[model samples]
Target: MPTQDTVQRLYDSMDFQRAVQCYLWAIPIVGMESARQTLIDNAGARSGDLVLVTGYRDVSVMMGSNVTTPYVFAHFDLTDRPLVFEYPKGATAGSLIDWWDRPLTDVGAPAPDKGEGAVFVLVGPGQKVPDDLPAGARVLRSRTQRALLFTRGLDPDPEKVRAVFETAKIYPVGQTPDGGRTRLLRFKAEGRLTSMEHPHGFAYWQRLASALKGESVEDRDRFFAAMLQPLGLEFGKSFEPDARQRKILEKAAVVGEATAKAGAFRKRVPDMRYRDDSHWEYLIPQSYSNEQDVPGGTMFEERTAFFYEITGTSAAVLSKEPGSGSAYLAAYYDKTGAAFDGGKTYRLRVPSGVPAKLFWSVTLYETDTRGLIQNEQQIVDRTSRQDLKKNADGSIDIVMGPKAPEGLEQNWIPTRPGKSWFTYFRLFGPLEPYFERSWSLPDIEPQTS
Candidate 1:
């Protein structure tokens, strides 16, 4: 058997090929155990530190404002595994539909009057949302709806919440609560600052490094127990974030290593492509810049989709001309016109080459909520492979407005009055120019004045 130190050296030196082999064969059991150890060594969490855990719907809130939020959380009382129904904060604007109110709603509410900075407790699966509350009291139904609970007093802002999610120590409590025994605890500002430096990443890496040092298993457990405090600080009421779930996430991250061999791997890989770093800008680094990739652009090779950040500095890096061997992926608009007048006829001209092995399409959607273009036709129109009017020179023109041209009825995409709209272009198969940035799509120019 390899000593922990030996294993550490091997893990650090393994090449891409060797890494794949190790991931496939060795990491499942021992690898996981070491990872848990690493998490413990790093996270120096105390027993009483608060934590929060949520499901997909709650996760979506971090993605975008328009997407529907899920309601999945069990408020857990740490002392006793009692569950409590923490209602999604907000007012009953219309019917059963609810809006989330944070530090705002907590004010002047009943007993748990968290001024602004408060940490909400995670209820376990054994608990149920209590119904026998006062008239104004509400309940969070499922994990698929948008819900909000902060540490009872620390008016946790959106930014802090995001950071916690990105790197918080987590433990897996193999079993879900049998009855409704979950609970939530509200934490105040005093709790937030107690251990500000021990974020999730710090704890994870520290623990990982320690495991490689050949520490005893009991020491690893002790470290793990220490890490659990911060992980539990952001608690989930229903179930403890168990070990198996963490393994799933670890394997998922390494899945990217396969992209090291882009060419041969492409053929063998399922849905392979690249992911440009631009997408993570506003979402990650907290800044959004006009991503321009001319000759020197970075590329991320993913299994499903690909991304390229283009910078058109000299001589228009992307081509606007038609029939070019470029993948005209998509054309999006924030609004139909400068200011929607409702009755005026607006037109958008998209200049792109449809370079595809199978087919191509241009789809129009209302930007309001992305549900669809709510109009009399009730149809989300598109120009797909089956139909597209090619120019004599071999290019295509897509029309989006109220009415279609005299001869271009088939290519017309309807629009709603006073509403904003956007468009998307999809290429069926892979193209070389798209990956290399040799060809480019024409800009969507507004025609109507």
Candidate 2:
């Protein structure tokens, strides 16, 4: 026996709730759509084309990448035929992920192929995999035809990277031996941006629709498929949003971007924190799966956070074997628990007992864009591989601010005065000390001269 006004109010409340739910659900979809579009754009929308994306020079803010290792990227369409990926003996680490960002298999060193690489024959849904394969080749079956293959070089030396890059080959099965050679496309250091950002307005929905049409939907993703129905986004259908739908989607995109940003900076997972008082935290879990402490299950928030923070994945980030994979820790605040301000100088000291089997590095990034902070030096990071001056105690000091401290130019990472920034400390081939917490990193302390 409610009045008309009460009934109207109840309906409005339901509508508002639905809008909020839709916004949250769209976050991951937007992420997937952005990544898919990036791959497509880089590959020239052509399937089975490989692009060698990384330079001999150190990665800078130009590409928004901080990776020290040279990288290779490729887009694959396996609907009609299987694709073959051959790796060189010295290939380091990489992964093949589906359009939904679900990793199918690890490639190179961390994989069964090890450093002495092997051929990976990728077969998609309904594609016939040849029974007579090479003796040592591994078969990788993917649920979707649309896949991304990313591989990294072990050494950053220009000559070493070129040597490794020359060995990777991709081609459709049954193609001639000469046709199996991949087209090498080097990344341009100028004006390149690899990080995926949230799409503007209803274009996000358009990209989602295009991705859905290009890729197969998994059973686990059926729920999201159903959710998109209300917004007129369906597989194999045109995503022509109506006026009202466009408005809703536009608002939803804004909210989705905010949610992703919050999740990246203020993650709620307990295992993310490396130390109680420090801003540094483990960016990825030891397990490849997103489950916090468990073996399986999707940690949706954690996955979203990671995609928003960085691109690409590898078994190297998840392997349990010490010195086999790698580990990453990121910090946003100084020792006093204050957000890092580019106007103020800070110093981070790596103690003598740093734990890294291969090497370690600290790279700075703009807080908002997650890109390397632009500086006069054009360099984004300092690594153990570099011949750096060390203190008497065997420790190393890295200074950060607008200007270098006295004669510490070699150890300084410049930060723009008006912006905020963060740093990621990477342990390539991390050892037991890092996992067991026996080795600890000192907090970034503010330096007032």
Candidate 3:
């Protein structure tokens, strides 16, 4: 017969293990929950409603976002009935992704409609498609109860971007566009509307519990769902953790975060390194599949690393051919392999002939929030589309530090002393050289002089 104390310790250990796994598995949904909760709470927007996050202040609040483009998106619930979404026929690119950060379909450039305007009939998991489908509408089958329609306006002119947004629409299948309760809801200013960082402590589990409410239990998730029961989380039931269970869950949350931070900041994977000579890493490899499905199983580690620091994924972002979608490279450290110190100064040299057919941009994000670095300057990015002075050959150097580097003010982005940061170098419409590795981007160097 086992002693009571020994049995209790064993049970506690098991519970902690399960809770840790829950945290890892729910990374994507937690990110999804943060975005959805923000729109509904801050903007008072509801399902099927399109909320446009425009301007620098608002767009900067989102994870892995840049102010160069206007973000147009909607959170749609298909539990009650099917919804119809219309993508405008203009300059834009992005995708409608499900809860797992899986793309339901590409919308703009790489989509079937190919920037030529398209209609979609979104059907929820196990929901029967109505017979009266629109003639030209494509059916989007979602495995989750809710889906997010995220896209970006790619025009250089602001008015043109607004025009593109005006043409977008979403409505329930049975309702006319006019009768639909959901419509475009644009806030003039982004007043700290949302923070994309996932909740912490017991709140993390709470958010996970809420996310699983309407979500159908997949075969893969059934085991994890069972594991959650002993730890006070279950579908169709309130998650009221007992004192011991709450302790275990709370402790697991801390460990989970540390584990995630370690894996993200310095991922151990071989392919994450963008180039052997550089410290820059690839955000998502060009070969990463939309669903992350591989030979034997899906790439959970890669998916976890991505959603832990960012949001949505799609085929358009994983551009295979040259001059198509986009390519993303990130740097968590400097040339000497040291984490970016906000207190220190650094410079990144953009060599001439960058292989982006459209444009390229460099932006900074706070290490913790993974959102734009908040500072006195308020500006978090510098791009080729802006007034960057390229060399006679199209090369430009960007400076980052606590203060503007004398004459380099126009090309400088302000950094805070105590807060560490990371950056992304994006090549939109990446060309053949980018794929062929003929063009190379160097690592950021700490400025000594």
Evaluated at residue 136, the lDDT of candidate 1 is 44
For residues 282-307, could you state the per-residue lDDT of candidate 3 as single tens digits? 98854467787778877777777888
For each candidate in turn, the TM-score is 0.30, 0.88, 0.96
Clashing residue pairs, candidate 3?
none
Query: Per-residue lDDT tens digits of candidate 2, residues 42-86?
Result: 445356655555642324422236657776667777877887777
Candidate 1 local lDDT, 264-287, one digit each (tens): 112232322223321101111111
Task: List RMSD in Å for every model shown.
Answer: 20.3, 3.2, 1.7
Q: Report the lDDT of model 1 for residue 218.
A: 29
Model 3 CA lDDT for position 251:
99
Positional deviation of residue 237's Cα in model 1 after best superposition, in angstroms: 2.9
Best candidate, TM-score: 3
Deviation of model 2 at 423, angstroms: 1.3
What lDDT score is found at residue 89 in candidate 2? 76
Candidate 2 vs candidate 3, TM-score winner: 3
lDDT of 1 at 333: 27
- Highest-scoring model, lDDT: 3
